[model samples]
Target: MTLEISRLLELTTWRVFDVADDGRVLAGCDESGSVQLVELAEGGCTELTALAGAVVGRYLPGERAVVVQHDSDGDERGQLSLLRLDDRRSRPAPLSELEPLVRDSEHVHRLLDVLPGRIVYATNRRNGVDFDVVIRSVTTGEEHVVHDGGGMVAEVAISPDSRFAAITVPATKPLSDQVLVADTMPETGADQLRELTDRDLAARHLHPGWQPGGLVVTTDAGRDRTGVARLDPRTGGHHWLVTSDEHDLSGRLSPNGRTLLVLTAVDGAHRAALHEAATGEHVVDIALPSGGWCGYPLPEPVWSPDSRFAALSFSSPSTPGDVLLVDTATGTCTPLTSSAAQLAEETLVEPTVHRVPARDGEQIPCFRYAPAAPDGSAVLLIHGGPESQSVRSFHPLVQAMVSRGHTVLVPNVRGSTGYGKRWYSADDARNRLESVQDLADLHRWLPSVGLDPSRAALWGGSYGGYMVLAGLAFQPELWAAGVDVVGISSLVTFLENTAPYRRAHREREYGSLIADADFLREASPLNRASAIAAPLFVLHGANDPRVPLTEAEQIVEAVRANGVAYEFHVYPDEGHGLAKRANRLDAYPKALAFLSRHLG
Candidate 1:
């Protein structure tokens, strides 16, 4: 039953982005750009007709969600708008009969907050007041910015009491810099006044919130910048509420100050250990099926009203997300949702662990899936985030490979999160080479576990793509083929060409481009394409906001010039992921054919 290229596309989901306040009520803007709300109230029904074309931003109360909608026209985002039920019994009504906002091209709406009674919130992002505080009084329909700062208004936060507002900024751009805070919309604006700074600029920190008495934050305070602390909002004093010998203490107080949770790395993935809020004491550590939990835990675990259980959605790279309810009293984990249905009829081959040793002797942890088929070959699947993990999961992609007689191995190399902050911080400016070598070791080490060494190939997107090139460059014969899906060819060019929004975060994860430019160049795959050993396949989405198309093009150009065997595919309508069904079906089979030709 060989499937045609066109048939694969038909099986893919042509799902659009459905935005809802919570997970329950869903609404979608179809290709025509009309916002149609899903009707689950009357029955499992969906209507074809409703509201205007393309919402830049839409909010429905009880449906309580506010998301930044992507703009179609220019670089500018749109004006913030609120939609709600007239009486909580009927369909959502636009806050004002006035037309949905069409933001002037010059002004882009970056922040939005929705309040009751059409009291929509906005940040005048263009002005230094990026944190626009447009408070619409219920009695009067007037609107305005409350606390107009002179610098960029990064974000706006409303207190639970609904009586207070605050604006936050990075203080200044480079992540090592201090965090700045200012209060917004006060009765007098005096009691709300406070400024906080730090002298130990090297210490890691994050400004979580400001409570009635002071500010509560998570930071690597005493333990190499690896613990959470509560700080005096005015005086800049701080102390850790919970501290561990290992620097994994995280999760902070919620808006209401009722609950707190911390994620600590254990043997596998990370264990989400809960804490009691009133006194900040250890309550229970959540468990996963084979052992460790998955995904990055939240600032606060989902809590039941009766304080009985906390809900968490977890997955490993081998596992997709499965919601779980943990009993606070007994610390027993219960799956709220059943395990993922067998993927495409493949047996659920659980992943096993192995440590890939780097040149530096630091071990890289990996999850390897043994194929049920005796095809006598393995496939190495790498993850992007260099900062994220594969997690335990029932991923369809992995299943597809396993069903096709391939063993898949995902290595959580240096810079992966949930291993503790420092392990993640290890892949900074001076250490990119270490991360690259980790993958090379995995390709060399696969056969010790019964995985055939000669037929292995490297597959990844984004940083994972970067891994493919790095592997080919470092150990050409180690892998039979390579697939670089939107990977960076030159780290230097990636930094130089990245958009303004990514500059700050990238600086935190990577070193300052100005200071460590040489490091980026030294580790770049373009520099070593001459040494590449395998046939390569590359793909890029035209509209990707994260890794731009230039990354793929540069690598392809270099690979071609080097006379390396390769094929390149481009999709015009996709972003970072294959959102459209047509594009994925076209890409995967093309990739499969390319791999099949070379790997054999």
Candidate 2:
């Protein structure tokens, strides 16, 4: 069952991020950036090979021909390449030779902000936690460090005037991340600096992006409704743009400082609302399907450079997500990218949005996928992000099941964000039971909506996979069969037994092992093994860093011990999700066989 070291290494690395510039949708083959260039009119995608891991420079407007990319996956020892779009005409940019100062450096995150003359990025070595913000110049090619040390920096906002840049810093030290504030652009000397926390701020803030006068910060009042605060970095002065004790406010400050957009279920449901930054008056609201992503829904709502149109999308469970263009000027909406249009209309299943009330009366949002009535059997599709929201996106997987005559249900449980901060906060610490109840309530409702509950299947990945095991043991009668992909069987053991390096984030997201011992034990699926009541299929990668390989082994052992109907699959050469084409190809068939036998 153990994989040789070489085979495991092959699966860990990927080869084809580089494609020819023909520009069709390209497959994401590896940690190296993958991109798909599609010809909209014809639906033909030309792939530009030789492109790096990320689509770097925006091509000439309207050229639409090729994409240029950079391979950022290369660390200090890996191949650091800056590849151009489909050709060797342009010179390749040399990725820094610096050894990766951090693992998933993108996790602690190495962000690079490019202004006309200056560039800023984080210098982090692989497998290391400590980080520093470093800056380089485009015109002159000079490099320097901005921050001395790091804790998890994100939302790197470069001020328009380029006179200063704003960054949000939070470290583990006492009073370190307590009051949110802004730091100035670093100069050659560390001695010359400005810190804005002295200005007096309230609440532990997040998502600190720049506005006209200062940076906008989102905060909750002692774990309640979130409010918006704008601080003038220069003067250490502040203003509360909008405050609500009941409905949490979500703000996305547009690129230009003139318009500030706020959202909170404006459509009788959570929807996107625009506001004037200076007056704090509501400007306009965009409608969304009831119970969808709360803020800037219809898509991420990209404000055109001129601030004229808000480009986004609105999606539901049954319906494939559609890209949209909203006119910020006239409030007109247009569907630009319709993934559903690619499919035949008669075969389309409509997604109904509703939240199942849990034991605590908390509404966990769920998308119910209803197929035609001839076949009432359906599958419950749970999303992984105990911290993520299940929004309307084009999921080829969901569509495939629908094509095979199966209904799919996706639930954004207690841990999901965008239902306001409270919904996400409710899932913290010892609230794992609430999340489990959220799924139970959702499943209990399936039979009422034409689905034959006795014939349903439980399928999920990551946290969703964790929910699968929890479902079988906690609520066995809900499904006939179940599928789990890279799920943690026990929180207590996962914290104590997994890779020491990844435990840092695992502790922060789930709960600290030492501090929340009792809760971790209760949250583990392994603790309730005898309760499993359905056939199960568990799949995991042999070299996964986050969940590690042992989680699957331990849980599978328990499944075997109880003599439950189960099958265990570990992709030896693949880590996390399958990266090798053959391994991924092999998984589809194995899943088909397992589901057919169990769901039948």
Candidate 3:
């Protein structure tokens, strides 16, 4: 059944951000992309605040107050705000007014943990480039820097006893980074920080969280595949807690530090497990609902204070995301919200996973969704983040196109995560265009699945958007139409104009502009705009900071100058992607209409 754009928009999407200590309330964003506090008993949600940008909130331990992270114009220089649930006031006050400890600068601050009378966080406020672990008092509003060093600080985990903070420093090589445990004493300095793991310098060690005896982290340190391990903060010794043949394995310790919730990526799908934290013995293998894998940032299963139930957000090919409460002991799952119940009931296409061979003999993983009725047309939906993978997540655009009888293929091309460190970085720098070649291979492989090559369209956002532009330019005769959503048109321009704090990270992944300028220009779609033979649709947000609006404007100008059939759109309030429901409702239908007009 073809669902209307309005019905797709009406689907209330929810994410389980944080569960209250008593497990009575959950905090997340509602359908409108606004911060909301949800009551577990009544399944009712209260809209807390409506900001112009995206916001992620976490509840302070044992308190009704929440710490929210938001940025201005999607620059990603996030700031933490405090909102009191007990306040009878009309709206929660700003962070600058409520918490004097936080600065209103272009710095990123993330709440780590809330202790008895203190709140621990990590911010780049110290240098505006590298993050430092900071602990601030809840009542006095005084803050202290616990760890400030050279490398970028990723995740910070505070011990239950409030004695030490475990911080993960990501390196170019996923495994070679270091996890340091710093004493949270009043006058702690850089000298007080002790490296918990001997740097492998080649393997990936990430997602550090505190367990009862030591630190639990995801690492591929002596193993071919990434797995969960326990590290001794005192001796710098560690042992693998869970290992699998799968490429990615990550886990989180429950609130009571007794149960460990483990998630592994087998091929591209996720398999969850519950393990005993002390002995690392498997308790029960979780049966995830048939849909997509849990959404990214991979919702760390929020455990009830009693450790009986865990809350997380799950989405699939057919349904939008919703919060689910899983019985940790029984392995039974219950839906906490009915956000996607109706959509799940709809006759949506269930995607079949396929491993298509690339030009270079490498196997490229893809999910293909074919409409029941034949339309002799297809669309290639690429994922962004040369580092991100396209999982079985609920995709409204894909569903809409499929419902209209367009076969959709979502490929996890080279450089996508969840495929091990080596595979994840395969297309870095000069090797990037090989991913586009993979797309070309996808075009050749389409007919094997009963798709028409002549009527094919390419659509993507962010990095995927770059792929669409590249496909149209390089393989000019391959595609009938193309859509770029907030995608980068020029690699050189994107690196030069992206936010200062993000420039270094992007350079590491995409190649240094100073060193690889010529290569970047050659690889950019803007440079090859004259080669584009297909009709193109470009959509972007004016306030985007990552792939700045200029990325879209320059390409649109080039495409129009070339006299190619093209359409352009910009959302004034949106930062990166269309996070707001109203904008999506307007954009998705227009995109589908454009595809229909051209591809059909």
Candidate 4:
């Protein structure tokens, strides 16, 4: 039985964003067309904010209110607000009634942490470029600029005593960052800040969480894989708590300060374990659903007040996004949310992990999902981030295409994470075209996995979208068709037209406009658009802030001038990617139809 594309598109998914002391869960669900805030407490679900795109939130100290971070119709200009628990309605509320704590259509205000009497956040309201960590009083509404980061502050962690603020900022190298510790309330003339990690070394220091004595951090400094370490705020000394020889590890201390949840990245899947924070003793290995991953931004498990139970957002190839409650003592995993929308589990396909050898002898990690019935054609789905990976998680588009009898291949080419720092940085700057070559390598090696190279189509979003256009332009003879969603066509134009604050950050990975303009132009697919003869389908958001709408128009225009077969559409109420289900329903089915005509 074939699952209709509309049915897969309409299926609801939820993630446990936060867990309260009283056992209340704040989750984001797509049950109402778009992702909205909902409260799960005492055996019932309460509707909170029905906002646009996706919303991020955390419960206030007493669990009486929540600090919500939401953006306008995919614009990505996030605003912060405080909504009282008593004020929430059983029905959806209009945007106008949700009064703002800090609202600006131009500047982004991200919610970091909600403490007892204050809220900590990072905002670019001052210069609209550099983000500053701010501590605002919940009762008095007074603001304190704790760290005036000269550059972008990636993460922030307030000390248990509210004395220090640990933040990470982008380092000089690509895919690397440095941690900085600042005094939350400095005295009249004291030195307020110090760099915890060596500024001389280019490494990734992430997920700074405060414990009793110091900050628990995940870093790959002076090492190949990320590992857990404890950073002393006063002396700036790192004590390695746990180091893995094979895989990357990220540790987060529970609220009770007794246990630490450690997630190890084994290939693309996650292996979770709990450890004693004081002695660093291994407690129990959490047995998550086979092939299930605690999905990205790579959130820490939301622990209960007693630190005995943890709520994790788990998903596998067959499962939709859902929450799982784990018992730390016995490692018992229980389902907390039903996000599959009652779809039969057997109807979905699970991908088998593979390592396709590249021309340079490097093995490229990939996931292959074969259809139940043969269609003789294949679709190669590229992940964006160029720095991100296609992990073992529920992917609606992949499932729908597989249901249509198309063999799907998701490759983590060079520059993809979950492998390590070396692999992720393999395609940085001057080596940009090398990662593109990995696509060609995959094309040649497709036959070993029983896929026909000539009948394959390309599909991707963002950087992956760039891969679609690049694959069509550079390796035009290999693909049958292409589907690009908010991808970059020209690297030069992308750097020039992208959001101001994002330009410098992206330049670190894709090469800069000042020094490497010629290379950026050469590496761009739009320059070789004339070589592209394959049928193409393009979709973009009119208000996308990351890649911008111009990137899509440029490729679409170039292909049109060449008289290449193509289809293009823009959703006015989206950004970066399609967040609303209605747009996905309207766009994806057409993309599938286009592939069917060209590849089938």
Q: What's the lDDT for all of these models? A: 0.58, 0.56, 0.77, 0.84
Across 1-600, the per-residue lDDT of candidate 2 in tens digits comes to 211222222221111211112322222222222322222213422333333333332222123222222333222111211223343333323334222222243433343444444446654453355456656553365766555544445445666665455655552321123333323443544333466654233234655557656777665634456667777776545578876766667676766776765666422235566788776788777664433532222223345444565544455433344444556666665554444443443344546677666666666677766545436666788777676666654344565566555678777777676565666756666777777777678777776776777778888887888888888878876768888888888888777765554455457667787888887887788888777778888888875666766888888888788888888888765555554445545665566567767666
Worst 10 residues of 3 by lDDT: 92-101
Residues 516-574, candidate 4, lDDT per residue (tens digit)?
Answer: 99998898999999999999999999999999899999899999999999999999999
Error in Å for residue 166 of model 3: 1.5
Candidate 1 lDDT, 1-600, residue by residue in tens? 232434323321111222232232233322232333332222433432233323333343334333323333222334544333333444343334323433444455553444444343444445522444456543355665565544434445455565555444443323332444444445554654445655335444553654565555566644543566666666767756776775356564544465566666553456677675545688776676654555442112344323455555555543444455566567787664433432364245677777777667778878877765547677788788776666655455665666566778877888775455566767766777777777767766766777678898989988888888888887776878999888888787787776555554566556678888777778888888788868889988776666778988877887788787889888776666564555666788888778768666
Query: Where does candidate 2 have its weakest 10-residue lDDT segment?
Result: 12-21
Best by lDDT: 4
TM per candidate comes to 0.76, 0.73, 0.92, 0.96
Each candidate structure's count of clashing pairs:
21, 37, 9, 0
- Clash list (residue pairs), candidate 4: none
Number of backbone clashes in candidate 1? 21
List clashing residue pairs in candidate 3: 174-204, 175-203, 175-204, 176-201, 176-203, 291-316, 292-315, 292-316, 292-392
Tens digit of per-residue lDDT, candidate 3, span 137-166: 877888888788755766777877777788
Best candidate per TM-score, number? 4
- lDDT for model 1 comes to 0.58
